[model samples]
Target: MVGTALGLSLVLLFLSVPVFLVFGLGSGLVAIFGLNLPWSTLIQVSFGAVTKHVLLAIPLFIFAGLIMLRAGVARRLVALAMAMVGHWPGGLGVAMVLTMGFFAAFCGSILAAITAVGSIMLPEMKKSGYPPAFSVVLAASAGLLEALIPPSNAAIIFSSLTNVPVSQTFSAGILPGLVLMVLLIVVVMIRGRAFSRNERAGWGARLVAVRRAVPSLLTPVIILGGIYAGLLTPSESAAVAVVWAAFVGFFIHRELTFEGVWSALKATAVTTTVIFSIIAMATFLAVVLTYTQAPQHLTAYLLQYGIGPITFLIMVGVICLVLGTFIEIVPVFYLTVPIFMGIALTMDVSMLHLYVVFTAFAGIGLLTPPVCVGIYTAASVANISADKAFPQVPLFVGVGVIYGVLMIFTPWLAEWLPSALH
Candidate 1:
């Protein structure tokens, strides 16, 4: 029965069915036919799943992210990053990493960062003699930080599902994001030695860049800072960020137009709908799994096989990586969480730790092949074939996997900040 239901889900996914249907129909059928649940069970669980307050943060963050991207927030921040690092050997390489990290601080989506920031950086990277594959790979991989940083919708969703505080979930990602940043910096520095370095910007230019960026730079601080300080909830912080982003767009930067806000709203609506549906359906499936005692059985199976926390986490990485190739990032996240969370409890694994690692692996999914949306987006922005970019991905993805294992060994890398903040 388990195998059949899993097969149904995979088949529906392969047919390009909507994820809501994949979760709803595939899991629903399993519940009804295999588990003897009534059809009404689906409606009850799906509707309940979407009602959480933390879910409110998602659409708000998405809207603010879109507005900031169009308002040239990435442009100003990229300038500041280049000014800070452009004189160093392989500075553009380092600059790209910094730009992605800085962009991540404002924008919360990896695909958006890849598209918006990559367009700005990839061409310069090519002009500066960086390899095309290297350029796309860097943009796609560093783009992961967008989802890892504060104001991350991914973190917001995880917090909602797991009952963790949103601020703590956001804080948990800080060190791992920084550690990955340093690793990329080192790799780029060595390989970047072969690429041409830009002439250092004059102090006057640096000052101007900093002056222009200061308003945009305050964005992450205002959004995440308020949350950490306990002055605002995640939803409230998102609301404030949206207003601040629009203010910067309309008055400060003057690049954002009325049409941009409208488009951002429409896009946010569509994205929010899709994400909410996935969450709803995933919740339905989790209830179904519980009814069938699947979690207990799976836990017993793992223990019977002598699996421990380390092995279980490694298995999870493998599972997420494989599913990510076929499923979009959000659906992959919700689809796996129910199953993983259950078994993780039995292993004495930290649920918070499992979630942070899960989110990190989702980033790698964007870099993984066949469905590497992150790479394709970066490649398109770079005007290179994704096939050309594929060869370069393994190294970055390997580093990411290493970071996942590192997080496993050093759970404190994710847990410490969240705990301290509490």
Candidate 2:
């Protein structure tokens, strides 16, 4: 029954059906052909998934990102990044990476970082004589940091689902995220020398750019700092972010008007609805899998065949990497995490460790092939092809894998922050 449902789901996904639709169809198939489960369980699970308090973070984070983008925060950030890094070798690419990382820290959504920061930086890089392919690749790779940084909706979701402390998940990601960014910068620098050219901005001008962006730049400090300082909970910090973003956009930046607010809200609503819908569908699928004891069966079969826990984890990572090539991160999380959580628990894996490992794997998916959403987004913004963006994948994926392995071996990285919070 599990095999049939899995096969049907994959087939539907390959045929380009929406993820939620595929899940619903697979669940129906299981009900009709595999099991005699009541259909009403599906509705209950779907509703329950979205109704959780932790799920509130998703829409708020999305809305905050939209507000930042609408308020010209991306422009400010890019200008500041360029001012600081644009004079370096492959400076424009470096600026893109830095700006993307910065935005990711606050917004916690790769799509938001790519659309907001990439939209501005990609064109600038092209105009500045950076290779279009490099520009696109850089933007795409940098965008993945959105999920790595604190206040990330993905981190929040993973923590909530795994019952790990969200604060710990946020901190566990910090060093790994930094490591990945450094590797990305190195790759860009090595390839960037060929594209390096002179820019005319003086120190004075650069300082002025920094001054203009200070408010926007402080967004992350406010969010993460407040959380770390124990001044607010993650949810409260997210609320502060929304209010701060709105204030900056409307009053300080003067970019967010009534119409701008409406547009941002509409955009936020559409994205939030899509994400929550997938969550609902995945919830139902999870219930079906759990009720049918499919996870238990699979775990027992794998263990019976002599697959060790580490081997199982590595296999799970590999599967997620493959799925990521075809699907977006949010849906992948929704579908895969529940299935894997059961296995991790059976293996006595620490919830924090599992969350970090899974997140690292998910991060890898953001850079993988085919439907690599980050790459596609960066490519579109930079006017480059997805195939051209492939070369940059090695650096990004390498960093992600390295960090994932490190976190797996040394559980402290994933546990320290949350422990401190307690």
Candidate 3:
């Protein structure tokens, strides 16, 4: 019965059903018919799933991201980046990577990171004679740091699916995000030979840039600082983030207006609705998986078939990589994350290690060839053909793989900050 339901899901997914229905139609029905589970229980579970307090953080963060997007927050961060790196050879590249990492901390989604940061930096990178392909690819790939950075929507969703604390997941993602940022900057410098450097900003200019960016920079400090310091639950931190973002956007930046906030609220509604739908369906599917003992049986079957933890981890990476390329990263997550819990439990892996590391791996799919979402997003932002960014995919994906290998050896990288605070 479990195998049949799983197979049905694969077929329906290929046929382009929405993920929620894929879960409901395939797994939910199997539990109903095969196991005689009641639809009432499934309905109750789905309703309860969307009620998580931590989930509140998502919509608030989304609203904050939308406000930041409209307020031109990226420009200030880019100014700071330029002041810091603008004089160095290949400084534009350094600035771009740094801005993406920083903005991701303030902005919630990769879409905003790439759109806001890419809109500003791509023009500069081009004017500096950075290879067009390199510029677009860099924006698309490095922009993924938003997912690995704190205040990450990806981490929140992963936590929701796995019942992991949102704060730990957010904290766990930091080292990987920072490592990837450093690696990307190095790659940019190596490729920076042809790109021209900007005139160095003097101390006065640097001070002005820093002064203008101080308010923007403080958003992440407030959000993550409160979470790490245990002064705020993830939800409370998110609410505080919303209030702070509005304050900065309207009063300090003077770019965000009432119209912008209304628009952001509308956007938040749409995005949250879609996200909660997926979470609700995933909750139901999880119940179905539990009812059928699929996760348990699969773990036993894998062990019986001689798969060790090392092999299991590799398989998880490959699955995320492949699915991430073809599917949006979130849906790839919905399909796999719940099933992995049972397998993750049998190993010595912490949920933080598994989720953070795999989130990075899933990000690679967006950066990989063929159906690369990163390339497409970059292409759209650069107003260039997708093929232009294709060649740069391998180099960025290679960096992600290297990060994965690092995580495999140094679980502490993902776990330490969370532990230190715990």
Best by lDDT: 1
Tens-digit lDDT string for candidate 1 (240-273) = 9999999999999999999999988898888788
TM-score each candidate: 0.96, 0.91, 0.95
C-alpha local distance difference test of each model: 0.84, 0.78, 0.83
lDDT score, residue 101, model 2?
82
Best by TM-score: 1
The alpha-carbon lDDT assigned to residue 313 of candidate 1 equals: 90
Model 1, residue 129: distance off in Å is 1.2
User: What's the CA RMSD for each of the models?
Assistant: 1.6, 2.4, 1.8
**Ranking 2 against 3 by lDDT, winner:** 3
Clashing pairs in 3: none
Return the candidate ranking by lDDT, descending: 1, 3, 2
Task: Between candidates 2 and 3, name the one with more favorable TM-score.
Answer: 3
Clashing residue pairs in all predictions, respectively, total 0, 1, 0
The Cα RMSD of model 2 versus the native structure comes to 2.4
- Superposed model 1: Cα runs more than 4 Å off: none
How many clashing residue pairs, candidate 3? Answer: 0
The TM-score obtained by model 2 is 0.91
Q: After superposing candidate 3, which stretches have Cα over 4 Å from the reference?
A: 369-371
Q: Arrange candidates by TM-score, descending.
A: 1, 3, 2
